[model samples]
Target: MSEQYEYVPHRLLRHRVRDIASGVEGELMAVVNENVSESGVEHWKELAYIRNASGREFTTAVANVVPT
Candidate 1:
């Protein structure tokens, strides 16, 4: 069996990004590590913050975006 690892979004920060799902382009502003609780289980996730040309800021999963 192969080993599995957690995904980290840090490297994607400060780069231009395009959302795979929405097709929106923007600059990656930050990657935030968040602790989430679900059904009494704790989990850590990385969220990417982005700013578009219109000056709108939004947060999304790193998997949803790619460097453009």
Candidate 2:
């Protein structure tokens, strides 16, 4: 297990971004990120580690994930 956060306020994100140009459907997972990057490239700067509905851990690009 990478890391699991429960009962904590976090951004719930699902993998497999539809608007993705790669056309890759990803797994369902939660995401995490830094508050604000000085470079302003923070959105796509890093990946947010998350766990899918199936209880599988996964990581996705920041831009590829959205808050739910």
On residues 42-67, what C-alpha lDDT tens digit does candidate 2 reach at each position? 33234555554455565555565543
lDDT to native, each model: 0.76, 0.44
Query: Scored by Cα lDDT, where does model 1 land?
Result: 0.76
| TM-score: model 2 vs. ground truth | 0.35
Q: How does residue 9 of candidate 1 score in lDDT? A: 53
Per-residue lDDT of 1-68 in model 1, one digit per residue for the tens?
22223435567677899988788899998776666656767677777778999999987887898989
> How well does each candidate superpose onto the true structure, as a TM-score?
0.70, 0.35
**Highest lDDT: which candidate?**
1
Error of 2 at 26 (Å): 11
Q: List pairs with backbone clashes in candidate 1.
A: none
- Say what the RMSD of model 1 is: 6.5
Clashing pairs in 2: 16-26, 28-52
